[model samples]
Target: MFKKLLFCSTLPLALVCGSCSSLYKVDKKTYVIEVNNQNETFNNLSKVSGVYEPRKTLHDTLTGNYLLRYKYKNETKYDYLNNYFYKNGVSAKFLKFGIIDEIHLVDAQNSTHIFNTDEDSQINNVSDFIHPDINRGYKNPIYQIQTNNHNSINSSFFNQKLASSKLIRFKIKNNIYWYNKDKKTDILINSKDIEKSIEKANLSSQQTNELKAFGIEKMDFKANENNSYFEIKLNGNFKAELFLDLIINNKIFSAYSDKFNYSEYYLVKNDLKHTLYKSVNNANDIQSVLIKYNAAGKVDKPTHAKHLLNEYHQGLVSSNLLDDFSDVQQKQLIRDFNSNKGIKLSVVQNFSNNIVNTIMFKDFIDEPDKNNIFEIMMYGKNKDKNSQISQFYSQNNIDFRNNITQIINKYTLNFIANKTNYYDNFISPNAIISNAQNTNYLKVIDANDHVSKGQINLAKNIEFYPQDLKKNYYNAESFLNVEKQLKSIHFESISKNLSNIIDDFYKENSNLKNKKINFILPLKLESLDTRIIEKLNKIFNEINQNLQVNIVDINSEIAKKYYNFSNYSTNNTIEYINKLLLTSNNNLINALTNSNVSQYKILNKTKQLLNKFIEQNKITVNLNDKQFLEKMSEFSIKLHNKFSYFEIIKLINEIKLLYSLPYNLSSNIDLDSFKYELIQPWIIKPTREDNLIYFEDIKMEGKNE
Candidate 1:
């Protein structure tokens, strides 16, 4: 069976009743954010006829806010207040009507925050407190409901139900075993002995009595028509649900406090063969004793597993930066949890260019305190170029939001501008219009193509038509230039608006310095031809004459590195050698083809290798061949077709030696010294020569001397 099991943790907290005021004094700037309100907490709140605050309460004298903290009966119980104004940086009543029954998040006149709920009446004050600029969550929230109702639960009911009844499912298999809670000998049980196993299993007197009365239903051990194995189901009574512990053979398997169920049994599947189940007592205990831990918050280079994310987005692999999850870690986590093997944090941050863009994670196992909140601390060179680090706490901190906006804006602008820069500088039809290829042809055609108007009457005004045509050509060019100017203006406008928004955001909170705009320019290389190379040489010669242009013959490089006769021919070694000198049919007619069939195959492989290199390197071929550039074009193409790797290297060295001499042979003041200083250093001379053939003991003259 191919099944994808998703493990999710429902965070549960206690529901304490809070009294409401009759005359609600709604402050304009105050906003209320709600969390974890779909379980029994909402149910309990709906049942209450009157607003009732519990007797015991803690009042913050400084902030005029009351915090109702639940005393945890045990370690698993959560103690955070059911309702309290999360502390504001300033001692102001930012949450005026703190977490009311019909919560409305108000802000001055433009009240943008609204919490969606099941009951039309369920909505009042609760809102999601994400960064105002981040319109969507990093990943959308996925809800897996058992029933078809698919209703959004209210705050109080969700909180209470989640605390008591949460279910975790695991798949079991035949011959599967587990180590005990105390790490003793392996305990194995069959489907028939399951009830007897529970009876003899480790449990307190109260738990034994509870299990006996609840009674383990005789399991359907006979595999279904599909031939799948049995599943384990946990059934907890109301009180047992709070401190429910699964003890197998004096070993605690699993425990849950906030685990509750509307139905009696929560099912676990035997999804795989040879699966092992865990008999651990506490979740925290399992983590510490079993898990091979990777510590949190260490910045290091992380490895990524490949995933085909989307079909629509296709670009150069180097161009697209992705924030992807590690499928290896995720699969490992799932396998461990299902096999009763323990689980660990497999958190990964995906980034490009040293900027952390996305973070993916599994669920948390810990309960929370009032102080429990997500905090991201960023430290780098600030806008002022000062060495400093800044801490941004969630809620009541606008500095964090401003900084986040800056990062998003800067990155997005750079992405758009990079593409535009490529088009404007090189690819666009109108780019470098003065150097356009077809302009001379257009002028020649205009001069030659003329109409004889001797038959036309003088009064017909034919000259006006010619004038109109000329005016239209100039107008179109002007229009294109205007369009380019407008695009440039639009980019400037967008950048200015972004800066203004950032400035206005920090106006009230002026502790932050303005961010510096950093533009990343892509490293670009132009297509090579003889003319371009000569022009580059002239520029280099003026600046530093020692530089020389070298073109490596990729085909020869491939042949030299890797060539075997067996790779191309299935014939015997003797036959392959004989075929090298034999004549080939008309099929071998390409530029690099020759009379020999075996040699042609080798040459074809070399050509294929060179083409692959060209694609990967993003090399474009120059095709702007004017009359003056015809020689350069023919020479470049000829070298590509005729020369092997070593032959081209030899040609370049020969040209360097020839160029080293002055225009007049006798003009050099000291020929030997000039060769040592200017000529020999540029030449890669062979160590020894035999019968005009050079060997590879190449050395530069200046370095060796």
Candidate 2:
């Protein structure tokens, strides 16, 4: 018997062989097969016969049919003498060796065969032939069927390819969109390009629907998420621009926080490049473009305006600057006037209409416009007292009369009412007593130091003013005194007003502990004068007692610690000790390692050293000679025992370097002292709450009158 391995290296190997006289020469090929194995195609197996008999013995084997056998290496096992035995399993078949030779299955077609090798089918027992599961396991028909099933599963599992989406990039030439090196031309737009890609791109579903109610068209591309391509099959060709919008996951693309760059997609029409225009909506969505189609700038204004009006009517866009007539509304004012000659007259007519509707003096019940009131007050003050204001009105063919009470209400009381808001809201909130001059009319300082022109003060008893009335005369010294007196009264008024607001705020919140109130008054020593301190004390005392608000004075405590160190007291020494323990770990350990102290020296002072280190008082204990040696001994043990022997030696060397510095802090302290204090064995108790105001200073500038 002769065994020869035949591998497919090149197609149709040379038929000549030296051992042609050998009988039963089996041709074997190597195949390694297991679960989920990758199969490779044999390129040289194209020339072979149809079939061969596996058990057929032949002389002159060069002319005999080719027998195909697959061999795989199996795990080794040892026998009784402890000798190793190498085994190989084989699946052999004699088949037609030729190009594209298909196998014929002759088994029970309904039954499937699975290869199962038993452990007892050893080479040593092969001659015994007691077990039929190995050599005589199945018939030739069943073997053919199993081989066919194996080949099919291996081909399907190892050779299958998956499908994926292809990216198609295009560029526009003139108005045509071209793909693939200009070999293909395609129309990329639908009628909904503007409605979907631009207008409805940023609009919410409800907003889009609302615009749709007004005959606006919108296309949603979300239905094509699973489709490989947006196949635009145009029946009859019409001109389509190469305009594109980003479609992600078949939805119109959006990036909320970043600026979406669409500049690359804009096409140049004429001399200008046209990009998608963005109009911000009520929902703050940037609707990309408003026009349904791309149009140049020649008539863009009118077209855009019309679209804007449409969007506005549907409540998609609001706050158009021309919603009410103003001078800044461009030439839109001309659109309202029917005749060119009455254009100026129309302006005056609109003004008069607004005045007639808005200005009313009788009853003086409702709030008057303070800005208009201030204007009227200034206008009335600048007018002549000898002639009537109606003279010019009659000359201009305008029949208008200013009511006496309305003039007084608008120009005086109403003007002051406007000023009162500024004083109450801004000045009172910040505790500011203003000294700025109001030079339009006779400036008067009231008893409360509230400064306004006498012409505008309705509370003043002055019924009328002279047209030539100049500012009230005053000597510098008396003016200064009165100003000072008025300033004090003004501060008092502001304080009272603030108190009232605070009281009201507390009441309105259902008296929930107003956690929002935090007042930290940082002051210096120079500002701590008697009067200012008293005033501040009174204010804060009232706030703390009534409002249930307490402001911490951490600065004063720090200041006291610094300025009065003799009387100063704090638990910060322990904090410092704890920090030293953690932060000085490396250096302290090194110092102890190198020190010449004995183990007993360190242990003896462990407790005493820790107590002294973290003492709140600044007193330092004087260590006796014996105590010092004991502390050093304790220090050496505490550090030396904790680490490895090599680490201890290294720490000792590092400690030697540390002691060479200007000061040796750890020279007297034991390691146990550092360990105890550093770990922070004590807890800090909270301080009792009290109604004491701590501050450095409170200066009352330019003393109160």
Candidate 3:
């Protein structure tokens, strides 16, 4: 019985030992266990742990190495182990026993660490260790770890090797950053590097040409020691300040490289056709910048006018259009428009010079107020002559019914009337406004006002003056009266001159009375005054019925030759030669006789002679050099000497004789007939006696008989 008991006990003990050995078997596979924690001390402990657990007990007891991948807001840690402990494994009892706050599995083959935390415990003081190779990877863990702060591990971080490489570094606002990499680096960017990059940049032909035109090749760029700022040395006429703003504001540097990306800095380019502006912020880490360039062929009259109108309508008060206008004038225009008082426009069309003058007034029907009026004159190419009015209308968009008070043709009498009105009211007209003599209109208005002040004296050209007016009744009547009076005077003078000429012809050739007498007159027969023509016809009938007269214009070639030859023989050869010879100076007479100088030149020569005489004689004077010279000038003379007076009288007589000869010789012709009767002067008359007394007396006598 004792032997049987021993055998049974030994068999049971052997079976129990076999089962325990199998349950405690160790996992030899490596594992990468990740854990996350927000606690600062835990993160610090992980960082200090390196290849081992931070706590001494854990480091002594754990089986793997530990590493803090990176420390950020929430800490992430990686624990690598070659050997993993299962829930029922021999090392699992240490974690469950909770002797330490955290447990790590240490791989004896690789010496890597994997973290395992015990519930309701903390890590105490631990020693630091060497950092492990973060590039290593591992298999799945025996027991999967779960934590609240864990994230998806970056495959690149584990796969890629950590090595230093070349990178471009730049600073914006004194903050340095890597160009190829998002993180900061010690590599700094200098101006030379930027210049090289720009040189090697892939720029379009247009962009390159623009830069060349801007004189970029003449510019030298240098950076500060820290490369926080850049200084550009300008050469030639290159404007550094302007270019800095242009390049930075237009983001032109971005065309050089793709790595340039700064969030706080940017550029904008604005092209408004007439003007261009580029804006940049924090250029070269310095101040912000703005650049402007005005385009060519801009701000012309029509364009400027259009801009002014648009700006005015948009409530803008100041513009280049108002530059010439005073503040008061501008205010008047603005006030009238704003208050709906209305503006008046008068367009004077000048077809002769192909110009249109636009006059603006403060109000419609307002009297000529120069202060409230402004004028704009438009000139254009000949081809665009007819488009001026259209352009004005298009630019201004004025209301014709309300704004157009009058449209005056510059050549018409109405323009003269308007000008006179302005003058009469003591208002100075604009430069574009011109004055003219409208005799008919002036006569009526002046007569109504009982003022003889408006008559224009044009006695020099009586035939051309007081132009006939057929449309105006009052003007036609007045014109007829003037025509009759002028014709009567001319008729009497012409009749007397013609009668004397014919009488002389008869007296000289009495035997040729039967021959037809042909009288060639140097005047336009058709244009001669009517009264003179009628009187001449009467005289010819009374003198000789067969007499015939032929009229030729004095300006005609034939008439001009005849008159010139006659004057040369009668006046030039006789009177002029005699006068020249009579002069005291032999040099003057010789000069006049031989020189080819004109009459004007002769006058100049005479002045020089007089000056020489004065200089030679040393004439008495109490004056400075300037005053003496001025006194010697022809314009300074107030009185004429006896010889000068005689010469002037002779010249006047000669001119009158030459000018009036043609009209006097050829006055027997009519041009235009008067359409209205002349007004006779008012004459006083005696009071008429009543004829009823004689009628009554004859009736009574007849009844009594």
**Lowest-scoring 10 consecutive residues by lDDT in candidate 2?**
672-681
lDDT against the true structure, per candidate, is: 0.21, 0.21, 0.25
Ranked by TM-score, top first = 3, 1, 2
* Best-matching candidate per TM-score: 3
In model 1, the Cα lDDT at residue 547 comes to: 18
User: What is the model-wide C-alpha lDDT for candidate 1?
Assistant: 0.21
Candidate 2, residues 1-705: lDDT per residue as tens digits?
010011111211112222444222111110011111111211211111111111111111111111112111111121213221212211111112111112111122323222122111131221132222333331111111112223331112111210010111111112322122212335332222322333434554433332222222333322222221112211111111100101211122211111121110111111112112221111212112111212222233444445443333222221132323333333443342223321211000000000100111111112323333221221222234211222222211110111111111211111122222111000011111111111111111111112211121122223222111111112343243422211221233333443454454456444333344332222332423455334434444442333322222323652222111111111111111122233222223222323322322332243344445336333332233433333333333223223333332222222222221111111111111000000000111111111110110111111111
Clashes of each: 36, 29, 8
lDDT score, candidate 2: 0.21
Better of 2 and 3 by TM-score: 3
- Write one digit per residue (lDDT tens) for candidate 3, span 613-652: 4576474332334333333322112112112323322322
TM of each candidate vs. truth: 0.15, 0.14, 0.18
The 10 consecutive residues of candidate 3 with the worst lDDT sum are: 690-699
Off by over 4 Å in 2: 1-185, 188-204, 209-494, 501-545, 551-705
Local error of candidate 2 at 339, Å? 61
Best by lDDT: 3
Ranking 1 against 3 by lDDT, winner: 3
What is the total number of backbone clashes in candidate 1?
36
